[model samples]
Target: MSIKFWRSLPFQTGFSIALGAVLLTLILSIAVYNQTIEKVVTDSNHRISQLISTIERSASIAAYLNNDELALDVTRGLVKNDIVTGVSLRSESGMRIISGSPFNFKEESILHFPLASPFMPDEKTGELFIKPNQQNIDAQAKQMGALLVFTLATHSLMITIFVIFLVQNRLTRHLTDLANTLHKIEPGSAERLQCPTLHRHDEIGLLVRDTNQLLTAVQNTLAGERRLREYTETLEKETRKEAERDPLTNLLNRRAGERAISRALDKADTNNTRCAIMLIDLDRFKPINDTYGHDAGDHTLVTISNRLTDALRKNDIVIRWGGDEFLILVQQGHDDLQISVIADKILATLSVNIDINTSIQESIGASIGISLYPDHGTDPSYLFDLADKAMYHIKRSGRNGYFIHTPSDTA
Candidate 1:
């Protein structure tokens, strides 16, 4: 089954946006709760101080008259308010009025209000103390926090749901269909996508049209390029064969032959073995051209090449070294005896009669010269020169036998 790219990607995009909205809502809710607690505490403290202000006049009068009943009335009345937990009133006349939980009020939390003389405003008469209710303040703060969190969460949930719905129904479904259709299409085929009717004139429809055009262009270009590539490959192979092989005898040419001989010599050096390079020159080849025409001479060389190739092992390399000369590389030759055996075989193979057409028969004998790998030195050019000198030595003396080259042989 084909994997769906659009299904995974677009839905994840929607969820990421919705998740961000929800996380932001949570962070703001925490901050608002903290701020709400502080505001509630501040407002509760302010109300407690306001309560002390209200009873200041009554407490002052009580202290001036030294009345216990009046002080009690002021203290009890102040504590009756919901946010006030405790109250204490002290008079200069030694009268004290106390209300619920006044002993529990801490020094820092106590609210103090000073009472003055009724006639002399500067004269200090008495003081009143009040404690704000902390539990009631915290409860109110918690209630406000819950309401705010609920409102933010509800808004965030609604937005998240709307976003996911839009993505799955409006965006991802279309993209998933498009992806599935594209996956089925081969690159150079006639297949194409049809734009949805609902999404006509939108970005999705434009994309479909553009993609079809691109597919058509690719098919055309690939057809032309494939033909060109095949033609180029055929031409390249023909060119390589022409470079490496002789057209007349179909043997390896001088350049390819030299490389093959050098590689054989290198293998012999690596394996601690020996290789033999034999050079052959037809003793009386010019007479065939002079008597029977150059066409017969060409046929003579081709026949000689076939005979030489058939006489040797398949592992040996034979090369046409231009104008009546040929070179052979024998990689398995172990010593001078093996070299002599191979050279004698070549001389024997070439001594046979040649048919220059059925009416005429001619004999073109050959002189073979041999050189060993390390015996004649390693370089291919140097070995060929030594083998040439050996062939010339046979050509000068008896001109039918073979000679293995030594350092004393000279041109």
Candidate 2:
């Protein structure tokens, strides 16, 4: 799972808090309980040592005064020490003087007298032996047991409440705020998460700081995407505009003619009709531009352009074919004679005097080439080629005239 997802989970957050608290509490409790158990064991051993000292003193006094009954009372009292589970009194001659509990005599009791001490005293002096009080230890065990239960209950209750409050007030609120912030983000709107400022120097604060940093990165990403989208739209629009224009003439170019011709072809071909592709070339246009100024040539071309449009149908397309040439696409019925008639009409239209500049009103004429679909050629390119060849043939034969394309001319 992602860090964000794990951080957002309520159970995981609570579990983390509880785990930390439990670990700390266990370490502390173990240390304290070990010390308490050691103190109890030490105190119990001290009480046993004092009882053995009193019994030895009483035994010495009884032997010195020759008081048998008082010595018996001292021995009985020595047996009464609650922690002393077993006891024995042995004389210097290795004879057993007294025994307590079930055993009459045992080697372990004798071993305890020496084992309980680090170093035995003078060889002649008697010593005292002590054992642990199982019953009293049992009572202390019950008490420690109760204390342990109380400590665990108190610590667990406090820890549970603390973890619950920490998760609810800190983690849950932060995650919920983050979720709401994410929900508010819009595709184009300039908005972002505004996490509330916190004063506590804790993990949650660190988490909030990191979250804000991440949101900042997200905001930058969104902004960049919006800019890219806008740039793409503008580029697309400019590309579309460029596609419709003629680079040289600054008019609707060959691309426009193709679109118009395709539509016209679709309509004319449906009814088994025909369309005429008229290729018009300006006569002596290169010489005019070379002798005069290019500006004057361009103005002449523009003048000729206007004349051509005035002579043709409104539906007819007039396209600038690069330098000093234009293409006129016209829809016509199945009549080859009509194509010739339109060519004549165009010739007559251009025969008039055209004002090139303020002082010069020159005569500009065109060599017309005609190509008909399903008669001249079947395809658009072939028909365009046929008309182009015819225009070249007319130019080769003589300037300022017209010609119709034939299949043999193409070969």
Candidate 3:
């Protein structure tokens, strides 16, 4: 069990009150029982002493007269009281004049009194022996002990109940209400406690007010954090988009193109499929750039990029590799025919006349080189290199054409 569970105000209050009452009752009961026993024993002893004192004159006369009947009567009278278990009288000559029945001489201490002679004052006659009854004392002590236990138990129960009631009202109820309110409170929400006790000047009220303040602060902090997070996310998206796009063509740049090729290679490896890497280079593009200027060249590249994007499958990715150079990644390419068809479309699209100005018009073409993943090489760098080499081969043979790299071509 958690400490908080056990430390609940109601439970702690009840347990402490109950345990303290029980312990107090136990200690006091034992103390009172012992003290009562001692008092009973002491009073019995005093009573026995007083009874002997009252009968001292009679016992002295009986001893002086050498009267056996009188001594027997004295002993009998003493024994009648339950506290006096046994009694005996002795003469000056060491003769036992009288003794009660069942008298055991070996018992505890025998109360001894000197018998004075009536004829001669200050002269000794004999002694009287009395044995106090222990059983009677124990019986009285037991009775008092039972009564003490009953009294203590009654008081303990009453005190426990009263303490529990007092603590519940004073502390436990308020704490319980506070705990329930806190439990219902959700961080970063508009939820708040409606406790009227918060207006009080007590510590509990202060605590409640402070807790609500803390919650309000937390809600504000969380809301601000959420807004900040949302703004940060929007900015990151824009930044990433700007980083990955070419300024002129608005197509994927070389960095994004590398990432796309890596993703494509991973997909191809997983699906056991092939993809094509096509490198496209414009034919006779330098002459136009030198004649009409770089703005016209930029415009031409943007035009070609749009046409290529429209002509290829939606799954294919086109990137502006560098000035006047473009790269395309074709997904799920089945054969050379699939790759060649897309390359042919790009060449035909670029072959159309582009309007550089109202008074000027120019025509351009693109040479495309294709390489297959796991056919040319599994690595993207190796495949791109093969495609570049094949594009150069096309440029060497003739411009505005496409060629697929093969081992036989190198031979």
Using lDDT as the measure, the top candidate is 3
Better-scoring candidate (lDDT), 1 or 2: 1
Tens-place lDDT digits, model 2, residues 1-411: 134656566767677777776776676667666666666676777777766665665555443444546445665676776766665444343423343564433443232332121133233323334446657766775578559746875878697877778767766777676666757666445565555566236665666567667767777888899899999999998887788877545556887777777778778788677788989998867876886788878877777777778888777778886677788888764454388778888988777776666877777788988888768766888888888889988888886888888877643
Relative to the true structure, how large is the alpha-carbon lDDT of every model? Answer: 0.84, 0.69, 0.85
Q: Which run of 10 residues does model 3 get worst, by summed lDDT?
A: 94-103
lDDT of 1 by residue, 3-103 (tens): 56444767677868777987899898999889888888888888777766677788888877777889888878887898988888877766678887856
Model 2 misplaced regions, further than 4 Å: 1-24, 46-69, 77-81, 89-99, 102-130, 142-146, 149-157, 160-189, 197-248, 252-275, 283-296, 307-317, 330-353, 357-365, 379-381, 389-411
CA lDDT of 86 in candidate 2?
A: 62
Sorting all predicted structures by TM-score, with the top scorer first, yields 3, 2, 1
Please write out the lDDT profile of model 3 over residues 262-332, one tens digit for every residue.
Answer: 99889889988888889999997899999989999888888889999998888788999988999998887
Kindly indicate the candidate among 1 and 3 with the higher lDDT. 3
* Cα lDDT for residue 277, candidate 2: 92
Model 2: weakest 10-residue lDDT segment is 109-118
**How does candidate 1 score on lDDT?**
0.84
